[model samples]
Target: MKKIDAHAHLGYIGGWANVKMDVDELISLMDTYEIETTMICVLDNEVAYKAMQKYTGRIEGCVYVNPLEPDCLDLIDKYVKLGFKAIKLQPLRHAYCADSEIVDPILDKAEEYGIPVCIHSGHPPYSLPWQIGLLAERHPNCKVLMIHMGHGHGVYIDAALKMARRYPNIYLEMSGMPMHTKIKEAYDTVGHDRIMFGTDTPFHHPTVEMQKVLMCGVDEQGLEDIFYNNAKKFFDV
Candidate 1:
Protein backbone atom coordinates (compact mmCIF):
# COMPACT_ATOMS: atom_id res chain seq x y z
CA MET A 1 0.00 0.00 0.00
CA LYS A 2 1.12 3.56 -0.65
CA LYS A 3 2.24 5.57 2.38
CA ILE A 4 1.37 9.17 3.11
CA ASP A 5 3.30 11.13 5.72
CA ALA A 6 0.67 13.11 7.57
CA HIS A 7 3.25 15.52 9.00
CA ALA A 8 6.55 16.73 7.56
CA HIS A 9 8.58 19.89 7.00
CA LEU A 10 11.21 21.16 4.58
CA GLY A 11 13.67 23.99 5.20
CA TYR A 12 15.69 24.91 8.24
CA ILE A 13 14.16 26.34 11.39
CA GLY A 14 16.55 28.92 12.75
CA GLY A 15 15.10 28.69 16.22
CA TRP A 16 15.36 24.93 16.55
CA ALA A 17 18.64 24.73 14.64
CA ASN A 18 18.23 20.97 14.60
CA VAL A 19 15.58 21.14 11.87
CA LYS A 20 17.04 21.78 8.44
CA MET A 21 16.03 19.81 5.36
CA ASP A 22 15.68 21.14 1.85
CA VAL A 23 13.22 19.79 -0.70
CA ASP A 24 15.87 17.81 -2.53
CA GLU A 25 16.95 16.10 0.69
CA LEU A 26 13.40 15.40 1.68
CA ILE A 27 12.56 13.94 -1.72
CA SER A 28 15.66 11.73 -1.53
CA LEU A 29 14.59 10.48 1.87
CA MET A 30 11.04 9.86 0.68
CA ASP A 31 12.29 7.99 -2.33
CA THR A 32 14.55 5.82 -0.18
CA TYR A 33 11.59 4.89 2.03
CA GLU A 34 8.99 4.61 -0.73
CA ILE A 35 6.79 7.37 0.71
CA GLU A 36 4.46 8.32 -2.12
CA THR A 37 3.10 11.46 -0.46
CA THR A 38 3.78 13.79 2.45
CA MET A 39 1.83 16.57 4.07
CA ILE A 40 4.62 19.13 4.41
CA CYS A 41 5.16 22.74 5.46
CA VAL A 42 8.09 25.12 5.42
CA LEU A 43 9.31 28.37 7.00
CA ASP A 44 9.22 30.03 3.60
CA ASN A 45 5.97 29.76 1.67
CA GLU A 46 7.51 30.52 -1.69
CA VAL A 47 10.07 27.76 -1.32
CA ALA A 48 7.40 25.38 -0.17
CA TYR A 49 5.09 26.37 -3.01
CA LYS A 50 7.87 25.97 -5.54
CA ALA A 51 8.75 22.57 -4.15
CA MET A 52 5.12 21.57 -4.28
CA GLN A 53 4.94 22.71 -7.87
CA LYS A 54 8.14 20.89 -8.68
CA TYR A 55 7.02 17.68 -6.97
CA THR A 56 3.32 17.84 -7.61
CA GLY A 57 1.32 14.73 -6.64
CA ARG A 58 4.11 13.52 -4.37
CA ILE A 59 3.97 16.28 -1.78
CA GLU A 60 0.85 17.80 -0.24
CA GLY A 61 1.59 21.35 0.87
CA CYS A 62 0.33 22.63 4.19
CA VAL A 63 -0.06 26.35 4.87
CA TYR A 64 2.02 26.86 7.99
CA VAL A 65 0.62 30.00 9.59
CA ASN A 66 1.68 31.74 12.74
CA PRO A 67 -1.35 33.02 14.58
CA LEU A 68 0.77 35.90 15.85
CA GLU A 69 1.14 37.36 12.37
CA PRO A 70 -1.13 40.30 11.65
CA ASP A 71 -2.16 38.96 8.24
CA CYS A 72 -2.10 35.31 9.22
CA LEU A 73 -5.55 34.52 7.94
CA ASP A 74 -4.87 36.30 4.67
CA LEU A 75 -1.71 34.25 4.25
CA ILE A 76 -3.71 31.10 4.90
CA ASP A 77 -6.22 32.13 2.20
CA LYS A 78 -3.41 32.85 -0.25
CA TYR A 79 -1.79 29.47 0.28
CA VAL A 80 -5.08 27.58 0.28
CA LYS A 81 -6.01 29.22 -2.99
CA LEU A 82 -2.57 28.26 -4.28
CA GLY A 83 -3.37 24.59 -3.45
CA PHE A 84 -2.42 23.96 0.17
CA LYS A 85 -4.74 21.23 1.45
CA ALA A 86 -4.30 21.67 5.20
CA ILE A 87 -3.32 24.22 7.86
CA LYS A 88 -0.35 23.77 10.21
CA LEU A 89 -0.44 25.76 13.43
CA GLN A 90 2.76 25.72 15.48
CA PRO A 91 1.82 27.54 18.65
CA LEU A 92 4.92 26.47 20.51
CA ARG A 93 7.26 28.03 18.00
CA HIS A 94 5.16 31.22 17.90
CA ALA A 95 5.27 31.53 21.72
CA TYR A 96 1.50 31.55 22.11
CA CYS A 97 -0.69 29.27 24.14
CA ALA A 98 -2.68 26.78 22.06
CA ASP A 99 -5.90 27.81 23.76
CA SER A 100 -5.26 31.53 23.48
CA GLU A 101 -7.22 33.97 21.32
CA ILE A 102 -4.29 34.01 18.93
CA VAL A 103 -5.41 30.63 17.51
CA ASP A 104 -9.17 31.34 17.42
CA PRO A 105 -9.10 33.14 14.09
CA ILE A 106 -6.93 30.41 12.59
CA LEU A 107 -9.42 27.80 13.76
CA ASP A 108 -12.26 29.94 12.36
CA LYS A 109 -10.52 30.14 9.00
CA ALA A 110 -10.01 26.38 9.03
CA GLU A 111 -13.74 25.93 9.52
CA GLU A 112 -14.47 28.31 6.67
CA TYR A 113 -12.15 26.46 4.34
CA GLY A 114 -13.33 23.02 5.47
CA ILE A 115 -9.75 21.82 5.90
CA PRO A 116 -7.93 19.93 8.58
CA VAL A 117 -5.90 21.96 11.11
CA CYS A 118 -2.75 20.11 12.22
CA ILE A 119 -1.66 21.50 15.57
CA HIS A 120 1.66 20.92 17.33
CA SER A 121 0.80 18.83 20.33
CA GLY A 122 2.58 16.94 23.18
CA HIS A 123 4.45 19.96 24.59
CA PRO A 124 3.49 22.27 27.40
CA PRO A 125 1.70 25.61 27.77
CA TYR A 126 1.09 25.93 24.03
CA SER A 127 0.61 22.47 22.54
CA LEU A 128 -1.12 20.19 24.97
CA PRO A 129 -3.83 17.73 23.94
CA TRP A 130 -6.49 19.34 26.14
CA GLN A 131 -5.65 22.71 24.72
CA ILE A 132 -6.17 21.30 21.24
CA GLY A 133 -9.32 19.65 22.53
CA LEU A 134 -10.63 23.09 23.41
CA LEU A 135 -10.29 24.14 19.80
CA ALA A 136 -12.03 20.94 18.67
CA GLU A 137 -14.88 21.55 21.10
CA ARG A 138 -15.31 25.06 19.78
CA HIS A 139 -14.97 24.26 16.11
CA PRO A 140 -17.04 21.19 15.58
CA ASN A 141 -17.10 21.70 11.81
CA CYS A 142 -13.32 21.65 11.50
CA LYS A 143 -11.16 18.53 11.63
CA VAL A 144 -8.28 18.66 14.11
CA LEU A 145 -5.10 16.65 13.52
CA MET A 146 -3.07 16.27 16.71
CA ILE A 147 0.57 16.12 15.74
CA HIS A 148 2.97 14.03 17.89
CA MET A 149 0.18 12.29 19.75
CA GLY A 150 1.49 14.10 22.80
CA HIS A 151 5.17 13.67 22.03
CA GLY A 152 5.48 10.05 23.20
CA HIS A 153 5.63 11.11 26.82
CA GLY A 154 3.79 9.16 29.50
CA VAL A 155 1.18 11.56 30.85
CA TYR A 156 0.68 13.39 27.58
CA ILE A 157 0.20 10.14 25.67
CA ASP A 158 -2.73 9.30 27.89
CA ALA A 159 -3.98 12.83 27.49
CA ALA A 160 -3.78 12.58 23.73
CA LEU A 161 -5.63 9.28 23.72
CA LYS A 162 -8.29 10.64 26.07
CA MET A 163 -8.90 13.63 23.86
CA ALA A 164 -8.99 11.50 20.72
CA ARG A 165 -11.43 9.15 22.39
CA ARG A 166 -13.63 12.02 23.48
CA TYR A 167 -13.68 14.16 20.34
CA PRO A 168 -14.82 12.71 17.08
CA ASN A 169 -13.17 15.51 15.13
CA ILE A 170 -9.77 14.85 16.69
CA TYR A 171 -7.32 12.64 14.75
CA LEU A 172 -4.14 11.16 16.19
CA GLU A 173 -0.87 11.56 14.29
CA MET A 174 1.94 9.17 15.12
CA SER A 175 5.20 11.10 14.84
CA GLY A 176 7.80 11.78 17.50
CA MET A 177 5.78 9.28 19.52
CA PRO A 178 7.98 6.29 20.45
CA MET A 179 5.82 3.88 22.38
CA HIS A 180 4.36 0.91 20.53
CA THR A 181 1.90 0.22 23.33
CA LYS A 182 0.67 3.78 23.10
CA ILE A 183 0.29 3.47 19.38
CA LYS A 184 -1.67 0.28 19.84
CA GLU A 185 -3.79 1.94 22.51
CA ALA A 186 -4.54 4.78 20.15
CA TYR A 187 -5.55 2.31 17.44
CA ASP A 188 -7.64 0.17 19.77
CA THR A 189 -9.37 3.15 21.33
CA VAL A 190 -9.74 5.63 18.49
CA GLY A 191 -10.13 3.00 15.76
CA HIS A 192 -7.83 2.75 12.72
CA ASP A 193 -9.66 5.48 10.83
CA ARG A 194 -8.71 8.14 13.35
CA ILE A 195 -5.01 7.28 13.18
CA MET A 196 -2.65 8.66 10.53
CA PHE A 197 1.08 8.16 9.91
CA GLY A 198 3.62 11.00 10.10
CA THR A 199 7.35 11.34 10.62
CA ASP A 200 7.91 15.01 11.46
CA THR A 201 10.79 14.38 9.11
CA PRO A 202 14.35 15.55 9.79
CA PHE A 203 13.46 15.32 13.48
CA HIS A 204 12.45 11.67 13.02
CA HIS A 205 13.25 9.30 10.18
CA PRO A 206 10.31 8.23 8.01
CA THR A 207 11.44 4.58 8.05
CA VAL A 208 11.85 4.54 11.83
CA GLU A 209 8.42 6.07 12.30
CA MET A 210 6.94 3.51 9.93
CA GLN A 211 8.63 0.74 11.87
CA LYS A 212 7.03 1.97 15.08
CA VAL A 213 3.58 1.46 13.60
CA LEU A 214 4.42 -1.81 11.87
CA MET A 215 5.79 -3.27 15.08
CA CYS A 216 2.51 -2.50 16.77
CA GLY A 217 1.12 -5.56 15.00
CA VAL A 218 -1.55 -3.65 13.07
CA ASP A 219 -3.46 -5.80 10.59
CA GLU A 220 -3.46 -5.25 6.84
CA GLN A 221 -6.59 -3.08 6.80
CA GLY A 222 -5.34 -1.12 9.77
CA LEU A 223 -1.95 -0.60 8.11
CA GLU A 224 -3.70 0.70 5.02
CA ASP A 225 -5.77 3.11 7.08
CA ILE A 226 -2.83 4.42 9.11
CA PHE A 227 -0.41 4.60 6.23
CA TYR A 228 -2.51 6.15 3.47
CA ASN A 229 -6.28 5.73 3.40
CA ASN A 230 -7.09 7.93 6.39
CA ALA A 231 -4.82 10.76 5.29
CA LYS A 232 -5.96 10.58 1.66
CA LYS A 233 -9.55 10.83 2.83
CA PHE A 234 -8.77 13.44 5.50
CA PHE A 235 -6.96 15.93 3.24
CA ASP A 236 -8.74 14.89 0.04
CA VAL A 237 -5.29 14.41 -1.49
Candidate 2:
Protein backbone atom coordinates (compact mmCIF):
# COMPACT_ATOMS: atom_id res chain seq x y z
CA MET A 1 0.00 0.00 0.00
CA LYS A 2 1.10 3.56 -0.72
CA LYS A 3 1.50 6.30 1.92
CA ILE A 4 1.11 10.06 1.90
CA ASP A 5 2.19 12.05 4.98
CA ALA A 6 -0.45 14.72 5.55
CA HIS A 7 1.84 17.05 7.55
CA ALA A 8 5.57 17.95 7.84
CA HIS A 9 7.93 20.90 8.17
CA LEU A 10 11.32 21.93 6.71
CA GLY A 11 14.47 24.05 7.44
CA TYR A 12 15.84 25.05 10.84
CA ILE A 13 13.44 25.45 13.74
CA GLY A 14 14.96 26.97 16.84
CA GLY A 15 13.04 27.50 20.19
CA TRP A 16 11.69 24.48 22.08
CA ALA A 17 12.19 21.79 19.44
CA ASN A 18 15.57 22.92 18.06
CA VAL A 19 15.45 20.71 14.98
CA LYS A 20 16.77 21.38 11.48
CA MET A 21 16.28 19.54 8.21
CA ASP A 22 16.10 19.96 4.45
CA VAL A 23 14.33 18.18 1.59
CA ASP A 24 17.13 15.61 1.39
CA GLU A 25 16.36 14.29 4.90
CA LEU A 26 12.65 14.35 4.18
CA ILE A 27 13.14 12.40 0.96
CA SER A 28 15.41 9.87 2.66
CA LEU A 29 12.85 9.33 5.44
CA MET A 30 10.07 8.91 2.88
CA ASP A 31 12.17 6.49 0.85
CA THR A 32 12.82 4.38 3.95
CA TYR A 33 9.09 4.26 4.77
CA GLU A 34 7.79 4.23 1.17
CA ILE A 35 5.79 7.42 1.55
CA GLU A 36 4.95 8.54 -1.97
CA THR A 37 3.98 12.13 -1.15
CA THR A 38 4.23 14.59 1.76
CA MET A 39 2.55 17.87 2.58
CA ILE A 40 5.16 20.50 3.65
CA CYS A 41 4.14 23.58 5.66
CA VAL A 42 6.90 25.52 7.38
CA LEU A 43 7.06 29.18 8.42
CA ASP A 44 8.81 30.24 5.26
CA ASN A 45 6.71 29.70 2.16
CA GLU A 46 9.91 29.89 0.14
CA VAL A 47 11.18 26.69 1.77
CA ALA A 48 8.13 24.62 0.83
CA TYR A 49 7.93 26.36 -2.56
CA LYS A 50 11.49 25.48 -3.44
CA ALA A 51 11.08 21.90 -2.28
CA MET A 52 7.89 21.37 -4.30
CA GLN A 53 9.45 22.99 -7.36
CA LYS A 54 12.44 20.70 -7.11
CA TYR A 55 10.74 17.47 -6.06
CA THR A 56 7.47 18.02 -7.95
CA GLY A 57 5.47 14.81 -7.41
CA ARG A 58 6.92 13.95 -4.02
CA ILE A 59 6.38 17.25 -2.20
CA GLU A 60 3.19 19.28 -2.02
CA GLY A 61 3.41 22.75 -0.47
CA CYS A 62 0.97 24.20 2.07
CA VAL A 63 1.15 27.92 2.74
CA TYR A 64 1.38 28.47 6.51
CA VAL A 65 0.02 31.72 7.86
CA ASN A 66 -0.85 33.45 11.14
CA PRO A 67 -4.06 35.24 10.20
CA LEU A 68 -3.31 38.08 12.56
CA GLU A 69 -0.29 39.00 10.49
CA PRO A 70 -0.89 41.92 8.15
CA ASP A 71 0.62 40.17 5.13
CA CYS A 72 -1.25 36.90 5.51
CA LEU A 73 -3.78 37.69 2.79
CA ASP A 74 -1.03 38.53 0.36
CA LEU A 75 0.86 35.36 1.28
CA ILE A 76 -2.18 33.24 0.60
CA ASP A 77 -2.82 34.87 -2.77
CA LYS A 78 0.84 34.71 -3.78
CA TYR A 79 1.35 31.10 -2.71
CA VAL A 80 -1.92 29.91 -4.24
CA LYS A 81 -0.89 31.35 -7.59
CA LEU A 82 2.48 29.67 -7.17
CA GLY A 83 0.70 26.26 -7.01
CA PHE A 84 0.44 25.60 -3.29
CA LYS A 85 -2.15 22.90 -2.56
CA ALA A 86 -3.42 24.06 0.86
CA ILE A 87 -3.34 26.60 3.69
CA LYS A 88 -2.01 25.91 7.25
CA LEU A 89 -2.71 27.87 10.40
CA GLN A 90 -1.18 27.59 13.91
CA PRO A 91 -3.44 29.34 16.36
CA LEU A 92 -1.43 28.11 19.33
CA ARG A 93 1.82 29.48 18.06
CA HIS A 94 0.23 32.73 16.98
CA ALA A 95 -1.68 33.27 20.23
CA TYR A 96 -5.13 33.67 18.71
CA CYS A 97 -8.37 31.76 19.11
CA ALA A 98 -9.02 29.41 16.23
CA ASP A 99 -12.58 30.71 15.81
CA SER A 100 -11.67 34.36 16.14
CA GLU A 101 -13.40 36.45 13.50
CA ILE A 102 -9.88 37.31 12.40
CA VAL A 103 -9.67 33.82 10.90
CA ASP A 104 -12.81 34.06 8.75
CA PRO A 105 -10.99 36.00 6.03
CA ILE A 106 -8.43 33.26 5.69
CA LEU A 107 -11.21 30.65 5.62
CA ASP A 108 -12.93 32.66 2.91
CA LYS A 109 -9.69 32.88 1.02
CA ALA A 110 -9.19 29.11 1.30
CA GLU A 111 -12.75 28.54 0.03
CA GLU A 112 -12.26 30.95 -2.83
CA TYR A 113 -9.02 29.24 -3.85
CA GLY A 114 -10.54 25.78 -3.55
CA ILE A 115 -7.92 24.45 -1.16
CA PRO A 116 -8.14 22.88 2.27
CA VAL A 117 -7.22 24.61 5.53
CA CYS A 118 -4.94 22.57 7.83
CA ILE A 119 -4.86 24.05 11.34
CA HIS A 120 -2.80 23.05 14.35
CA SER A 121 -5.09 21.71 17.08
CA GLY A 122 -4.66 20.68 20.77
CA HIS A 123 -3.13 23.50 22.80
CA PRO A 124 -5.32 25.32 25.30
CA PRO A 125 -6.49 28.95 25.47
CA TYR A 126 -6.28 29.10 21.69
CA SER A 127 -6.30 25.85 19.68
CA LEU A 128 -8.64 23.41 21.40
CA PRO A 129 -10.71 20.97 19.37
CA TRP A 130 -13.88 22.88 20.25
CA GLN A 131 -12.38 26.14 19.00
CA ILE A 132 -11.65 24.48 15.68
CA GLY A 133 -15.17 23.09 15.77
CA LEU A 134 -16.46 26.63 16.08
CA LEU A 135 -14.31 27.61 13.14
CA ALA A 136 -15.75 24.70 11.15
CA GLU A 137 -19.26 25.60 12.23
CA ARG A 138 -18.78 29.14 11.00
CA HIS A 139 -17.21 28.13 7.69
CA PRO A 140 -19.28 25.16 6.67
CA ASN A 141 -18.02 25.16 3.09
CA CYS A 142 -14.30 25.01 3.81
CA LYS A 143 -12.41 21.77 4.44
CA VAL A 144 -10.62 21.98 7.82
CA LEU A 145 -7.88 19.56 8.84
CA MET A 146 -7.29 19.33 12.61
CA ILE A 147 -3.60 18.59 12.77
CA HIS A 148 -2.62 16.20 15.61
CA MET A 149 -6.31 15.73 16.49
CA GLY A 150 -5.98 17.25 19.96
CA HIS A 151 -2.39 16.24 20.62
CA GLY A 152 -1.53 13.89 23.48
CA HIS A 153 -4.28 14.52 26.02
CA GLY A 154 -6.91 11.80 26.47
CA VAL A 155 -9.75 14.20 27.15
CA TYR A 156 -8.69 16.37 24.23
CA ILE A 157 -8.49 13.29 22.02
CA ASP A 158 -12.06 12.29 22.85
CA ALA A 159 -13.14 15.86 22.31
CA ALA A 160 -11.52 15.81 18.92
CA LEU A 161 -13.62 12.81 17.90
CA LYS A 162 -16.76 14.46 19.24
CA MET A 163 -15.98 17.66 17.33
CA ALA A 164 -15.55 15.68 14.12
CA ARG A 165 -18.87 13.99 14.76
CA ARG A 166 -20.49 17.40 15.04
CA TYR A 167 -18.88 18.85 11.90
CA PRO A 168 -18.67 17.02 8.62
CA ASN A 169 -16.11 19.40 7.17
CA ILE A 170 -13.70 18.87 10.06
CA TYR A 171 -11.06 16.20 9.33
CA LEU A 172 -8.79 14.66 11.99
CA GLU A 173 -5.12 13.95 11.42
CA MET A 174 -3.25 11.25 13.32
CA SER A 175 0.22 12.41 14.25
CA GLY A 176 1.15 13.38 17.79
CA MET A 177 -2.20 12.08 19.02
CA PRO A 178 -1.33 9.17 21.40
CA MET A 179 -4.21 6.71 21.32
CA HIS A 180 -3.85 4.02 18.67
CA THR A 181 -7.44 2.82 19.04
CA LYS A 182 -8.81 6.29 18.37
CA ILE A 183 -7.51 5.98 14.84
CA LYS A 184 -9.97 3.17 14.15
CA GLU A 185 -12.59 4.83 16.32
CA ALA A 186 -12.36 8.00 14.25
CA TYR A 187 -12.84 6.04 11.03
CA ASP A 188 -15.65 3.89 12.42
CA THR A 189 -17.61 6.85 13.78
CA VAL A 190 -16.39 9.90 11.87
CA GLY A 191 -16.39 8.21 8.43
CA HIS A 192 -13.40 6.47 6.84
CA ASP A 193 -12.13 9.39 4.81
CA ARG A 194 -12.35 11.85 7.67
CA ILE A 195 -9.08 10.74 9.29
CA MET A 196 -5.56 11.00 7.84
CA PHE A 197 -2.03 9.84 8.71
CA GLY A 198 0.57 12.43 9.58
CA THR A 199 4.03 12.10 11.16
CA ASP A 200 4.40 15.58 12.67
CA THR A 201 7.99 15.16 11.54
CA PRO A 202 10.77 16.53 13.77
CA PHE A 203 8.44 16.47 16.78
CA HIS A 204 7.50 12.85 16.03
CA HIS A 205 8.88 10.07 13.84
CA PRO A 206 7.30 8.38 10.83
CA THR A 207 8.22 4.93 12.17
CA VAL A 208 6.42 5.62 15.44
CA GLU A 209 3.42 7.23 13.80
CA MET A 210 3.13 4.45 11.21
CA GLN A 211 3.28 1.86 13.97
CA LYS A 212 0.45 3.62 15.77
CA VAL A 213 -1.77 3.29 12.72
CA LEU A 214 -0.78 -0.31 12.04
CA MET A 215 -1.84 -1.34 15.55
CA CYS A 216 -5.02 0.72 15.48
CA GLY A 217 -7.28 -2.26 14.47
CA VAL A 218 -8.28 -0.72 11.16
CA ASP A 219 -8.45 -3.25 8.33
CA GLU A 220 -6.58 -3.02 5.06
CA GLN A 221 -8.95 -0.66 3.30
CA GLY A 222 -9.07 1.59 6.34
CA LEU A 223 -5.28 1.67 6.46
CA GLU A 224 -5.17 2.54 2.79
CA ASP A 225 -7.64 5.35 3.33
CA ILE A 226 -5.75 6.80 6.29
CA PHE A 227 -2.23 6.34 4.95
CA TYR A 228 -2.82 6.99 1.26
CA ASN A 229 -6.25 7.62 -0.21
CA ASN A 230 -7.58 10.26 2.16
CA ALA A 231 -4.51 12.46 1.85
CA LYS A 232 -4.46 11.87 -1.88
CA LYS A 233 -8.01 13.18 -2.12
CA PHE A 234 -7.47 16.12 0.26
CA PHE A 235 -4.17 17.29 -1.20
CA ASP A 236 -5.01 16.18 -4.75
CA VAL A 237 -1.71 14.34 -4.87
Q: Per-model C-alpha lDDT, please?
A: 0.87, 0.94
- What tens-digit string does per-residue lDDT give for candidate 1 at 8-99? 98877666566788888888988887789888988677887999999998888889888888988999999999999999988888888888
Q: Model 1: residues >4 Å from true position, as ranges? A: 15-17
**Which residue ranges in model 2 land beyond 4 Å of their true spot?**
none
Across 35-138, the per-residue lDDT of candidate 2 in tens digits comes to: 99999998989989999989999999999999989999999999999999999999988999998999999999999988999999989999999999999999
Assess the local accuracy of residue 185 in candidate 2 as a C-alpha lDDT between 0 and 100. 97
Against the correct fold, how does model 1 do in TM-score? 0.96
Relative to the unseen true structure, what is the C-alpha lDDT of residue 59 in candidate 2, on a scale of 0 to 100?
93
RMSD of 2: 0.7
| Minimal lDDT window, size 10, model 2 | 198-207
Clashing pairs in 1: none
